[model samples]
Target: MTSPASSKRPLWIVAATLLLGAAALWGGSRLVWSAQQRDGGVRGMLLETQTGAQHSGALVPLAVLAVAGVAGAVATGGWPRRVLGVVLAVAGLWACWIAVDGVSFSGFPPGAPVWQMFLGRALTLLAGILVLLGGLIATKRAGAMPRLGARYAAPSVKKTARDPDTELWEALSEGEDPTDSA
Candidate 1:
């Protein structure tokens, strides 16, 4: 028999991982990933900058999915949770790929701030890994997670009112005179 604490551990892990992953994704998206110098024919050299969001549109969606995964873990169980977990995992994998690709296509110029580019990519990668871990665990142990409003679940058994007619027929069948009481 699995203890409640043991079962709840996965839920905690899932919540933490999902929340952290989403944070990373959202943070990375806001960072400047790449910069470039543009030659102005009539003017001067103009610098251009690109961000993680500008690189790929998937970052925000992946982040949102991670957040939603946390909620789904809390609110759902059984097959629905499993499906959500699988989707979260897939989104994380996709984010990882996108992060790598964005960095590869950066085309950093000489003396470019490579740190920013790598940092953003690293954060995105970390987010993906965290979400992936959470998703896998959620899929495997969804039943153990707490459901929404679990504390207020209705009782499994309830007392129903006895019918007078049924009682009378039962007494008669048992050869007891229903009208006899001294």
Candidate 2:
């Protein structure tokens, strides 16, 4: 018999997966396109002198990731979804680190644009938060985990594994014994 909890499990899992897909497909891709525009040619020259846009091609992967992330979310339940979520979360954290790296780690000269720095950092942080949240939400709704200790609980020794004599007696008691010497 299927319990109500069991029946509703698939729906919750699908909803969470789809919501995650929408966020990645819409928001993540937009951020990438903006970064790319700031990277190509004469603007690239201005960006060259700037640490924030130094290697702007990073945006390409961002777009790819957006598509991939959405596709992964839509696939629903299993290790693939879990792994993709972790990857998304990690990528977000890396972006956040990149944004902040110039502040103390880059050792670049002191003329980096204050506004650009903040924007990059803010975007990365936001992505990290969203990815982590998506991963967690999907995991919660999946409910693939086993209940209580039912999986490991000992089987009834009186049934399938019953002693031959006991089985004979039970069969005799039930008047269905075919193996009885009598």
Candidate 3:
């Protein structure tokens, strides 16, 4: 039997997963591809260049987070769902660690403020958290909920006219005085 709440839960989970995936993708791109400017000239002229090697390495974790988000979003039921949840949680933690590490490394150009450097990593971390939450929610709900196919399944109830002998036996079993009643 399907309840309104049961049906709605997965939808919300999927939505959250998608949102997280998008955020991770966007943040990862920013962290990986965006360059910052540094003041080098007498008049405070700035030059734009790619981020340093330390920040560049963060891309791998962000990519893992993005993949986990998508996998968590699509996975359904049983061990598969549980596995995805675990994956999401681990990926989120990994991304968070990498992002936080990036914050401490003074790799970006001087003109880029600490907050600016942290923004993309922060978003990546946030996306990882969302993915982890969604995966766990889905796993917790999966056990109590029936599968999609179960909704269509119904016990085959065969209805037939009551037999005379069966009715008489039922009356006798109940200690009913059928003859006296007549």
Q: Scored by Cα lDDT, where does model 2 land?
A: 0.49
- The local distance difference test score of each candidate is 0.85, 0.49, 0.58
Query: Model 3 segments beyond 4 Å from truth?
Result: 31-75, 105-109, 113-115, 145-182
lDDT of 1: 0.85
C-alpha RMSD values across all candidates = 8.2, 10.9, 10.8
Highest TM-score among the candidates is held by which one? 1
Candidate 3 structure quality by residue, lDDT tens digits, 58-159: 555555555555544454556766666676666656655655663556565555555645666666666656665665665566565334455545436633
Q: Which stretches of candidate 1 lie over 4 Å from their true place?
A: 105-107, 154-182
Preferred candidate (TM-score higher): 2 or 3: 3
- Assess candidate 2 and give its TM-score to the true structure: 0.45
Clash totals for all models, in order? 0, 0, 0
- Residue-level lDDT of model 2, residues 87-166, one tens digit each, is 76565555555545544334333444444544555555565555555556545543452323444455566465268787
lDDT of 1 by residue, 34-116 (tens): 88889988887876778889988889988998998988999988899999999989988887887777356546776666888
